[model samples]
Target: MLRELPVALYCGAFAGMTSPLVAGSYSFIILAGLMSGIILAISKTSFHGFGGKLGTIAFGGVCCVSLIIYILN
Candidate 1:
């Protein structure tokens, strides 16, 4: 929850700042952040004891954004 807030904010801000250079697919970054947050939230509740879950969620989120951008462009 609170522990991941900084990471989310940093990732979201970075995504937004660099979005214009990403072939005009800015929304993907925001969506990625939102999706990452959602996935993390779900993972937290579903896999409380799991290890390295945040990293996995973050990677998945970034991968999703990349895929969307690649497909769109």
Candidate 2:
């Protein structure tokens, strides 16, 4: 878990930055980080090292954050 932290944080940071471009706010950025961290944390335990899982988590993090933000607004 400790080893994965940097990678997870990097993914969260990437998700946080890109989410704002599509959704347009710091709120979305926060949501993206939260969702990305949670999703990646959950997935890590089950991951089989298939290609692109990290990217997929990043995308899903941004998308879910966008959706949640839209719903809240």
Candidate-wise lDDT, in order:
0.64, 0.79
Misplaced by over 4 Å in model 2 are 17-20
Q: How well does model 2 score by local distance difference test? A: 0.79
Give the clash count for each candidate.
0, 0
* CA lDDT, candidate 2, residue 18: 85
Per-candidate TM-scores read 0.54, 0.78
Error of 1 at 62 (Å): 0.2
For model 2, residues 1-73, the per-residue Cα lDDT tens digits are 5887898888876786583359687777777878988998788777696887777888898888778767988
Which candidate achieves the best lDDT against the true structure? 2
